[model samples]
Target chain A: MSQENTAAKAAPGVEKKEKPERDIHNLGSSFIFKPNVIDDIHVKAELGRYRMRGFSLFKKIPHFDDLTFLPGTLTRFVIEGYREKCETKTILGPRAKRPMELDIPVYITGMSFGALSYEAKTALARGATMAGSATCSGEGGMIPDERRYSEKWFYQLIQSRYGFNPHHARLADAIEFFIGQGCKVGMGGHLMGQKVTDQVAEMRSLPAGIDQRSPARHPDWLGPDDLALKVEEVREATNWEIPIQLKLGAARVYDDVRMAAKCEPDCIYIDGMEGGTGAGPHLATEDTGVPGIAAIRQARKALDDVGKTGEISLIYAGGIRNGADLAKAIALGADAVAIGHAALIALNCNKDIEEADFPNEMGVEAGYCYHCHTGRCPVGVTTQDPQLRKRLNPDEAAERVYNFLHTLAVECQLFARACAKTNVHSLEPEDLAALTMEASSMAQVPMAGSQHTVGRPDMTRY
Target chain B: MAELESRDSHDMGMHDEQLAGRTQQIFFKPSAEENFTYPGAYEVDFDKETEFDAADMSNKDVNLKIRDLMSQGYGSITIRNPGAKHSLGVCILNRLQLTFDGSLGYFGCGLIDGPNVHIKGRVGWSCAENMMAGTVVIEKNAGSTFGAALRGGDLVCKGDVGSRSGIDMKGGTIIVGGKTGMNSGFMMQRGRMVILGDAGQNLGDSMYDGTIYIAGKYESLGVDAVESEMTQTDIDWLEKKLSIYGLKAPNGVENVRKIVSGKKLWNYDNLEPSEKKLIL
Candidate 1:
């Protein structure tokens, strides 16, 4: 989160410019009390409740952009950029009998059907299939088409158990136990009444048009010990075939992950504070969990400590925008990455399409809109309205999602090959160097021009 | 590495029945037709009865044996000395008459769609969790979270059940002949829970849309749960449901207390501006 700094110097032939005259009447403004902050207080005072929105955290954090790849130079031999093979094929939950194999290391994360339109959900399913990746039936249960279109599918057993069906679960390639989400660490999911149509209501077995507030705790099991027994139940149900993954929000990463490992899940998914939500409290989104850079490091260390590194796979999600982010995650210790907001962007989430009147309909310009909670998405990706939904063509959207996923995989390969790693999974922490001290400390990687990592004792001992 | 068995919608029977309009996914194209042909679902005969002992077998072996028997058309099956095995008799989707002479550990009879199951002994936590359409009956005391997230069919426990029983129950009839522990019917959405004996604290807490009928006194009510006037319809349902399991309320069905959601928490921001501002 370092701000850009530049110093001004006058040319030899030009005269130096004078500083602008300060207004004597002005006592000057408080940098701490910025206009946006003041406006937020005012809005809250009026609303009498916390503001809710659909997007990733607005505040900046130490992120993938702060970490730069130090690819092969003189010491190591580089693989050919495009010609040589850089294996993007990834496997998660290797210990499971039927491990989830992906052609690419990235897959679309779960976003519930009630929070999104049918077209958007199916399009993602079809797209992920085409990309040889996977799609998760997020919360409100499995839509038939989403299941039919997806080659590899994850059935999420969220706390709410909304529309959670064993028939649908039995059809899954894997099961995701939604213990928590990154966007709202300890909170449950929220789908505004606007989007809770009759179809969604029936699926979740709730009254339609009622604001759906999912429970944070699972109805059956309460703790990790019970979770172990619950895992056994699912394993027995699935005939011990598909993998069972526990998706945990990034909080007390080391301890939480250690406990999760004890539960004996095939995979552990860590969702960072930077993760986007279809709808969530703005405060929770900005302030809840640790950032991805830090979360992955702790999670990996926890797995290593537990002697389950190879047996239990780690999948990281939150604030991943492009290939470099995906590659950086793997280097930091993630076996794979999951993308939600980025995939939505690829599905024309904020695009200024022909049918979209963004400013008029959403009260913002195309790129500025984050109104998925409103169920009035101008681009049709997050809406249930038939007219708005028609704005998105599932066929084209599916292709775009495929293209986006493909580009990310290829881009991730570019970094891997440059780093002289034939396999994308071979991109290790040694290939990365942090541009900022926060990144250096959090990611536990060295600074850009130095061998010194901020938090490592050896660097300070000297 | 091994072949996966197919689990169909209750029956391998609903051929060509569209996933009903319940999904509200009307934009489905003819090309991407919903395929209901779950290839590996079994067709069994009820008259073909068999019994086995699962005293020494692992959960995987026991479940596999049951499925194998079903595949071979042995529909009415019994397992003796189940030995309090966890996850026993799970995810049985076919219409079979299954019985267990002994007790089951946690998650017994869970995720089942169509089965008439009887457990002669007690059951542990989360028994019959997410059962779609089935009759799961326990003769003795049941543990916590009994029938959690139950979707349909009849689930009965003649003896007392622990806390959070029927938590998040969707559509089903849970008739507990004995007392129930705290938070019974917590967050219940759609269903009828009939607790004939004394109900514990926080009865029918935070329910969305459901009815709870308790013949005895409830220690306390949880948030948004309130008592309502019992009608003839409630009496009829209680009487009919109780009779099926040969359960009679100590007090008459008409004297049973009814609890339902107050609809206050249903739409949190239904107060002022956008209802979307749920802080979760």
Candidate 2:
């Protein structure tokens, strides 16, 4: 078959004929493909996975504007190569007043241990720690192996309530009580039986091969008040030493944040509907939860209304890709941001193992194929296959994580410089303007300048 | 309207007689006194087609009224399309106290320990769906899979329960007055399902360590249930049970087909031998 015909048939309509065929490598397949000939093949954003054939066309779009950095003005200047350019040290502990403590603002978002191999969890913890950031354990419990790499670790107390590790008292820096994750709010997680290795099966207390069904609601506590009590129980169990944060998907976030505030939690991190998952049910990932930008605004309002604004730090996650998002979130009153799928990419997941035709033998195009719930992750990050996992070298992956964190920090500094600000927190609505009118209104920030200023921002809230 | 329905000759003669028999058999006569009594107890008066508006009821009064309502033994008081825009929020009434008063029969929600219950009448899926004391019985044969995950309590069906009655009962007894469609005790761990009539296909399919006694013939017994030794103790238990249900034990009580297995479906770690025998 002609290469063009084969490419067309491989993922119909997603790719078009190109002139200067570029050499493309994946699992076992090798082919020459031209980027431009493929209609609309301008995807330049090199972050995130592109799983289904449907999104490959968008992959052709370019991401960076020639590594654009913010220009330094007299007000704010960039200080590089100085012995003391800026102190990079941060203190994170569970007992601090700000309950949800973290070494760096960047943290590992929730990705189930069951969805990932033991090595993946270890690598994440190891990588996150190496990067001076914290890693949050997903619904899965605090595995002993993962504990070794834990310096600043957040344990997700999922609704499933699996893996109540005794050392959770000691190893955990903070207890993140997950009310509803953004990807699947008002739903339970479905860990297919095939993924349940003997170890995973024992940890989750389910049969080795029977599909595990997390209850739709919590087994013990039923409502917000009950969750408050459970939070108290954890506090007492940990001798009032640990700070508790409540994490919930951003759907009906108005009420959710209100309830979280009522619970008197130290931090409320909202995961926008766009949150990434190693593998969520198709319906949930595609259609559930509110977008992140709006969630942050709602959460901020909720906390402000209760006069608990600074008392509980607000963090937002879901589909956050670049420093611009970081800037927008802070302007929306989010204290920090957490990332999941991005962290995985930094760990070098979804990469072609041997530089072959496809990303992996699974015919998964690349990053988008995070259907790890099937236990057949073409790349090692999301699978239990020891051989596949071997392809992922933790040390190298750890460096990548460190590099990604460093890059994100640099980008933050650049944005701060542009807005004539020093600390990220210093960037306010007045300093920055959104690109879109809708974004400007939703963010409660002004447009580019006074010329486009329509009304006092307080009068409108989308 | 309810009074008129109760007086209807056809409804009275057939349904009332059957209910009376069932009541005598299930409740151990001189039954528990009607414990609950309150105004606006039943939303739907037995004969009335229209249901009582749950909105009219304050949450405070819902439980109390439902408690009293269940005692009236209305055959099929349905909370039609619950969890809908115009449906009553879940209300539980403890053990339906009323028997076949006829009036087209009452006997709805019996022994509601606590569950948002909505009964579509002529109900027959184990009056309780894994009822831990809560019950919702239907006057008609529950199609099948009644008491599938019955945890506790009694779900007495007035009509034939179609197949797989008490399929995976952990605790509780489902006494089907008529017949069991099939696979009656599929994986019943710790419960007794007394089927009064013929049982359908693969009855007690691979049933592990539970007692399913069918008064009539069983079409097929599944992978687990082999014949078990029916001892004198078994006969004695059957006789006592049948007498309560107002039925004499089948002739030659000494000879009865019993299906038994020690295998447990849930805990695969524990597997025991199967002993099937006709004990005299």
Candidate 3:
């Protein structure tokens, strides 16, 4: 038999059908071949041709969902929900002369006045006061209204030196030296000309309708030793009455935490990958910094390595949503948790607008809004426009924030009760378990239903 | 140092003991004078004057003592034999006058709100940094980042200043008697910098709304820093600032080169890519 005839005869009843070429338009793999629509729109279309505007890039990344709490069942005893009392109060910077004592472990992270409306800032302060927590004055100068409403306030000494006044520094309960933020780790803050109103310009001492770009690093100091001296300067400036906190983004978390601890700050504040910003470069927000879970683990380890675990307080920010997240952070060794995007949400950020004009008035649907940098927010929480800002009444918005904080505290207490912990701080890494191997390795905790830890060898002993 | 010891203990009766006791027990305030001497207090006598040294104590202790004295409203402190100590006379709230008789270290008189600090010798980095509504006079040379991030005050460096002098200055007058190192008045938003001697390269780099008056030879200027005609108003302002520090202009007003913000780099909307590079 001929070779071709023999081959065809060997595979009896097999059809010789030719396969068509694969389509390039719809590649099955989303990550490798296809271009991300969001990234293309922002990088290629918007910022590619013009100056960068203020808008945070939203992307899906690994977060707190990978971890889960191992509730008490047979080996551990869970407290009765009805009769037991779980403490939610937390103290920060206990080594300092005047440590910040909070009724609840949750605090409002720094969000500047240039970024948010005056009403929104006041509302945050009032809400934090009602919750017996603290609110921070962000990059911009401290507003009088916010100070009037807030019981305890943290003042940020950012690199820009915008609206930085000695009077405000002295007035703050604690001073936070803002080294970097999570949204844009190595980059500085940007406020577009549209957002620079007369009030904003006056506060920052900049020209009206001018784009303000803050320096990425401080002009005064460079290295960790220099930072230590600067910390001394701030301590002296506040008469050593208020605690000094070093705020850093979660990039090189272990090294950054170590350096910040060496500066002898009373507290170290770490902002992770999921932290929100008023505005930032699209590339920076999407592809920079470590996640909050991983950051907390490294920060705790760094503090422990330096033998300053409890000596210096650790405040964690980024993607902290509710009481469960707060409980998880505390368990990972955070003295307190700060909320930014969630606080704005509590102030009606993405809520449905019931006005008659509705979508037409804002030029966008309520639920799909993320135009905080435009200075024309429909919800009035992020806008500086007088008309838009009027929509957010400080008193009413404050009540919502209060309710949100109350709910978080209650939820945290419930979690503590489940773990049979008397205080929220008593929840340790042993009480947590990871749902995935990635999370188990990063958090150094045992995988679900397994006695072996993913990264550490002797975590079972913990 | 011996003059400080000869002062009568009875003369140190300015602060009431009860008020001092109450203030000391409060947050961040120094406790009652049990072991050490309160430098600013007139009635309080030191247990061992020779042993008390600001260099030996922490910046917290030094500042707390200064603040305690300032809290009494108004007073004078004579820090004798101060050897380059950081954060001397920092955050003095009231109109207390601090006289440093020797060299000081980094952040000396930093964030001075209302105090008048006189340093008789040279200072280390960031002397009078972020000073607000106060007067800081460095009798000799100042280290790098001198008067950095100054908000509202007068900082007079009688001698040369290091690099990045008067950086990010807002609403203040910084007078440098001798030469200034690189990037003087860099990113200065508002204020006036008067340089009596020569300037290093990148002078007034990226200055937004400040004025720079150089009476000596000028090196290369930074982007957005332009030489404008010196006006009578500029001369008058310079004279006023110099008079406060008991200084005289090294050169005539005609010889002075007045540098101001070009206002071209204020907004990036109209600027070309090349122009942006020039300012950035």
Candidate 4:
């Protein structure tokens, strides 16, 4: 080839690299980051982007109307901080004399070593410690520094067990046997072999480039009875000194909770349909599992039915944000809550920043970028790039985590006070009245405490 | 008694010695914290460094019934021939500590868990299933599905593994010095599986994902799975793991292939050839 021709071939976007071209299902990276892209199809309209569509027979209409909160009655007076005083000090895990102790309800969820950077895992532990709560290390065993943070750690033992140090066998404060995650139930986790570093490969104990796969059901367990037996095995190992926890995706909440209660674990954690992941097939995320609300309500009722109401604490996750959400969750019978995406928000992940070496035009911004499917987290929160990881200081990030938790607690406290409830658990459905029929009925709150009005509160207590 | 006395002073005194009680009183007590008891009426103290004298001790549920009586917070425990005359049948299910130096070793095994579990003989498959911690060393080969769904622990085999070794393995390390039959690392999610010898064909076939590393010649790689490029990160990782397994830096290891499943497909269809190449 001539020099001129070679120069043309080497030009930026033009290269000889042959990308496997296909017209197969293009779930591609398109929907991975953007929300509701499934509904945004481009179609011809009479009046395009400018004017109202001229020939359109149907127009977009608001789905609901006039939602309002119930006003306080004379018997139930609102306290200070109509701007401030509600309390949200909810406890997760049965503190009912269980051998294990977890100080905060809001804890970090599980993220595997292969899925995240070692730096990210360490940072999560640091942040959880800073926040005065626990961060979970995934099945990849205990990295040395991770073990150092064991005081504030919840070790999630996945199917592919790694980081298991015999000397540190008794270290974990709690044990969580990951069943089905909200993202994908019954499907195995896959870390693209290309991404598997030798360390990652070694940690997983596989041939260098071969894909790693976990079985759908536990090898020894076939059903709930088997699961309980396994739970007993763990209990025996720890001498019943640490609380055992079971984490499951919200697929069949009633059945799942029922089975979990049989094992008598200290807590049952539920992650809903919208659970986030570093990477997962699009079909699994969008098409699988029930939503968080249905799962939580069904599970709570299941617990009550089985006479295990206070036996196992219930924690709900999947797309939670702010004080109101926390209150709604508690009102729905959740003992506490877990935060994944919201935690990322607190850490300011996916930020919009201008840099010389930008990869794409659609700049990443906090809360909007779900580009974690690729290992390139531009904002340094999710990527494995050493330089980027250095940008985040665990100590500082951990402080932010602490601050966020502290602030959320204050807000919860304020709400509890407003409803005349001294404790968070005391602020019940009786104190809550939703503005929308959807929320009121879904939350099972007795609207108006009377009839016919979703937002109206019964003033008889007045 | 007079005839016994004429044989020898020692022999005459043997009956007297028996009357004198050579063995210490082995009292069995209930665990102060629990409602359970040792159940069986036999006890052996290793401090006498006594070789285990029991011929059929393996079939009993030891961890659930007798483990507490042996606790002294010591570093090592060796049980000789516990299963020599009996089928262990879930007796030592979760009681081996082969990895931790201060562990309880059951000499003969049908099933075991935790502590440096050195099996001087063969172990039944599922020997280390769902083991949360410890080491299981099998001097002989294991049956099918060994270390299946193993969460945390180490399983080191001195001999070949039967079919489906490390199947659906989530987390933990399984090192087989000899060759592994078919279905090794099948449906592996997370964790490293090091196979020193040649692997049977379709090593990770139908596998949705996870990593697999083989150091021998491959008759055939899995479907939708292709060779991945070995980056510097991969090199460093290989070196570290090699050092861990007491092997050299893997700088000149022969036929070291990195087989990878691509990012696209949920199972096998999307596995594309990787860009990096393994020199060895």
Q: Evaluated with DockQ, which candidate comes out highest? A: 1
Models 1 onward score TM values of 0.92, 0.54, 0.86, 0.63
Interface RMSD of each: 11.1, 28.2, 14.1, 22.4
DockQ score, prediction 4: 0.06
For candidate 3, the per-residue lDDT at A239 reads 59
> DockQ: which is higher, 1 or 4?
1
Name the candidate that leads on TM-score.
1
> Where is model 3 more than 4 Å wrong at Cα?
A1-57, A356-363, A456-462, B1-61, B71-75
**Backbone clashes counted, model 1:** 1
lDDT of 3 by residue, B18-125 (tens): 221112122222222222222322332222122135656666676676555544443667777678878777766556667888898888888767667788999999
Q: Write the per-residue lDDT of candidate 1 for residues B209-235, one digit (tens) a residue.
A: 899999999999988888999988888
Q: Would you list the rank order by lDDT, best first?
A: 1, 3, 2, 4
Least accurate 10 contiguous residues by lDDT in model 2 chain B: B19-28
Error of 3 at A452 (Å): 3.9
Candidate 3 vs candidate 4: which has greater TM-score? Answer: 3
**Model 1 TM-score, all chains together:** 0.92
As a TM-score, model 2 comes out at 0.54
Better of 1 and 3 by lDDT: 1
Q: For candidate 3, give fnat to 2 decimals.
A: 0.40
Per-prediction DockQ comes to 0.34, 0.02, 0.20, 0.06
C-alpha root-mean-square deviation, each candidate:
7.1, 20.8, 10.3, 19.9
Where is model 4 more than 4 Å wrong at Cα?
Answer: A1-71, A77-92, A95-100, A162-169, A193-195, A206-216, A353-367, A434-441, A446-462, B1-125, B130-145, B149-165, B168-185, B188-280
DockQ category of candidate 4: incorrect
